[model samples]
Target: MTNVQGMIETCVQCGECVEVCPFYKATGNPSYGAMAKVGAARSLFAGEGLTEEGLKTLWLCTRCDRCVSTCPVGISVPDIVQSARAELRRRGQWPQKCSNIANAIIEHGSPMAAPPQDRITYLGKDHNVREKAEYLYVPGCWASVRLPEVARASFQLLTKAGLDITTLGEKERCCGLFLIDNGLMDEARELAEKNTLLLESTSAKTVITECPGCYDVYKRVYPALFREPNYEVIYIADILKDIVEHGNIEVKHSGRKVIYKDPCPLARRYDMTKAAREVLGHVAEVVEFEEHGAEAVCCGAPAGVKPLYPEVANELAGKLLKEASSKGVDQVGVGCPFCMHHMSGVQNGTEGPLRIRTPSQLMLESLASER
Candidate 1:
């Protein structure tokens, strides 16, 4: 159990959290505010526990952590809410959507529910994945099953750059960020341990992922849950950026004006805005959305919100897309496959007002042009 007393003391209630929280900003509900969430959890901790209504309210958070950045005292309201969710799950009061995800992962090894044997099919065709290589690429569940293009492009770029990389294929499992967000820490820990062991089994010194959620788990959560990872975990954006800047790979300039939507975890959590933009500059004219970097809005995918409250998720994604539409860019480039999936779903058509593309996809376009 996290120390609610310390979290409660950290909030100054200055309305800074409310200002940036997706639920509060979209619905204008003070009860959905981040500070209010902390207060609610504090009350529950002091008393018996939260009611069903209180549990739902706690799950409303997108877990963007914007409030943590804005709080005068640096209170992590999302973490508090996550802790409350754990308590709710223990009492069987958690959301069914999140519970389903946890169950799916535990039962099926991946949240997408595909058989483990089919995992290698996500690679499209089996390329020679060396067992002992410098890079071990783990395409999180979303990219592996839902959006394989991003994974394929990332793999192609890595291969083209002449770096020796290996993949676990079906051996890879969920990084368990979904479980962690829903307060299923034990389940998350189990997955994390499995992933750590799998990565350690390889001679690769670095682990790469296209999913921001998986990267966050490997970079932040796993270290705390287990021992510090002996291997380095990297976002594909940073990997591609280095490949471009160091002259290992060259891409013909597309000259297309594109707005980049910074995935909340990548932009705010990992401080990866610069690397993403630096890579974008190599292929396209990088245009800024109305909100970029730490101030950027959520696309409605974080903290299991996309599956739990899709209406709310789509509403938030619509707002993000609207900002990009207003800019009149040719395409919207995103680093996170989760963000790209939601954004693509919200777009009007295959060739809508703006195309939603992975950063690696955009780079591949230019790289292909050069070829």
Candidate 2:
């Protein structure tokens, strides 16, 4: 369990973060939000016990870091949630997906449990992929297995830009952030070692990935866990930002005024908001939302909250849709596939014009500027 003593002291039960909480606003349940969770964690350290509801509360958060960014004292909700999750996991209250995912990652190299040979299915072999490339594309299991099309435009653009990029085929495994997030530190470490070994064998100087979860894990978590590292794993946002800033890639998208949905981990956790906008700036009439940047609300992805509480997740999307639609932006550009998957689809009860799109898709119709 995480030591709540420090964070508890930091959080004076200030209700400042209540407005920023997606869950709290959705469920009308304070305990599900940051301040309430902080109080519950503090109580536990003060000899109060965790109940079923309290444990479930920790699981309901998407770990989007909105609360922490909004908190005046910098109390980390994810760190606290992780601590509680680890404690719950120790006590065997972990969701079935935890063991299921961990086992899959351990054996199959990623949580998808598909054979490692299938990773190549995300992108086809038709392209002239090189052995010594500038960037290595490591799409996580979700992107590789379920959402291959999201990164297709990126691959097309990269090829057009003459990047000698290569993929790991079946060799690329999980970056292991999921395991680490749920407290499987040792397993995450092992996966990191495997990934680092594979990356070391490649001539790629930097890594570009479409998944923010994988991006965060590869760039941040692995180095912290493994203690040894090589190769700079970068988010596609950063890479694209460079390509645009350096005049390597040209963009000329100008159909609809769009808003970028900053996935929590992608925006706040990885600090890629400005760079992402800068890359897409040339192509898109990117409208800035009031709650953007680190303060950007979760589209109810990540942290596995959608599965735990569907209504709350829906309400979150509803609320966010209203917020974005109020600003008169029709299209919402998402960087993470998970965000796109959750936010873009038509919710059964909602009626709004908030269409979801991945940046790669947005860039597809936009003509590349003269290189």
Candidate 3:
């Protein structure tokens, strides 16, 4: 029922997409390439049935939309892949890893299956939290569970900037990004409704998040899937940009040359290319990746790829880090916590001298020096 065939027909098979597809570049497999995935989507829509390898091909995509950007006919391979994934989900053919993630989100409110009570431990006991505030900070699952330091740094920076921010704490839920990415639309919708109500209950005028997945879902996907959110959704980078430009807090330069990697959802999908750079430029000498902004490469961890195909994900991350090291930067800065998590994981395994830090973390370091 999805116009998969119509979309497939529009493709000229120009292979421009091959140049940008990280999955294909990492694997060197035609099936994992964007064009082949488009054909697979057409087959799935035509009811040709799913094969084991065919399903794997569909799941390999991070849905970064690099192919869509390069398409001569403007055919969106990510759109076709999403349709195919929805079809697979309808047939109960989703990968077990995806199902497990969905279950964890459903039962535990986190993809990592972390306990809800432990969610706020990262914030510590002595902190500024109110029942209602002007801005609600949703750190998403990654920052709250996996990357507590990033969450704390983000909170410290915002509070230092004198913003009236509060968090959902134990009541926070996964933005259902994994479910949405895996085509479990019904589950994603349920979480969207629940989170919308929970966030609206706070009477907050603005919703700020450090997670690109949460920002994208709340700002863009939620409205299309359900209704426009009652509060405005903003990325923390934008807020940090404001704070830095207005001199809300005293910051000293670190004299560290760093490459800032742009998150695909924030940079490509939302055109939010400047905020993170503006913030980073104030504290460190910000360097650009070979392909920066809309053309920047993905960190290769989103949309279930990190859990399902970690080798490929690591490969992509390694490539980025190698390039950064060659550029002679002291560190690689990212706006998205997941990018930091993935790239740092890879950096830890290697002897590379590069360090990974978010703009918030870097600014926090600068602020600490002043004390």
Deviating ranges (above 4 Å) for candidate 3: 49-53
Model 1: lDDT of residue 140: 85
Query: Please, what are the lDDT tens digits per residue for candidate 1 over residues 86-166?
Result: 877777776677778888888887777777666566566647556778889888888888887888888888989998888
Better of 1 and 3 by lDDT: 3
After best superposition, candidate 2 residue 270: deviation in angstroms?
A: 4.4
RMSD of each: 2.0, 2.9, 1.5
Instruction: State the displacement of the C-alpha of residue 252, model 3, in Å, after optimal TM-score superposition.
Output: 0.7
Quote the lDDT for 28 in model 3: 81
Q: Local error of candidate 1 at 215, Å?
A: 1.2
Q: For each candidate, how many residue pairs have backbone atoms clashing (under 3 Å)? A: 0, 1, 0
Candidate 3 Cα deviation (angstroms), residue 162: 1.4
| Top model number, lDDT | 3
**Which of 2 and 3 is the better model by lDDT?**
3
Q: Model 2, range 1-371, lDDT digits (tens) per residue?
A: 43556777878777988767878777787778778777666655565777777766777777777787678887887787777676667767678866787788888777668887566665776654456676788777767766677767777667667787887776778777667767677777878777877876777887888889888887788778775556787787777777766777667757668888786787777577877677667676788777788788788756666666666787787777777788788887777877776765534356675667777666666764322
Q: Over 4 Å off in model 2, which ranges?
A: 1-3, 43-49, 125-131, 346-354, 368-371
Structural similarity to truth (TM-score) of each candidate = 0.94, 0.89, 0.96
Model 3, global lDDT: 0.85
The local lDDT score (0 to 100) that residue 53 gets in candidate 3 is 65
Alpha carbon lDDT of each predicted model: 0.81, 0.73, 0.85
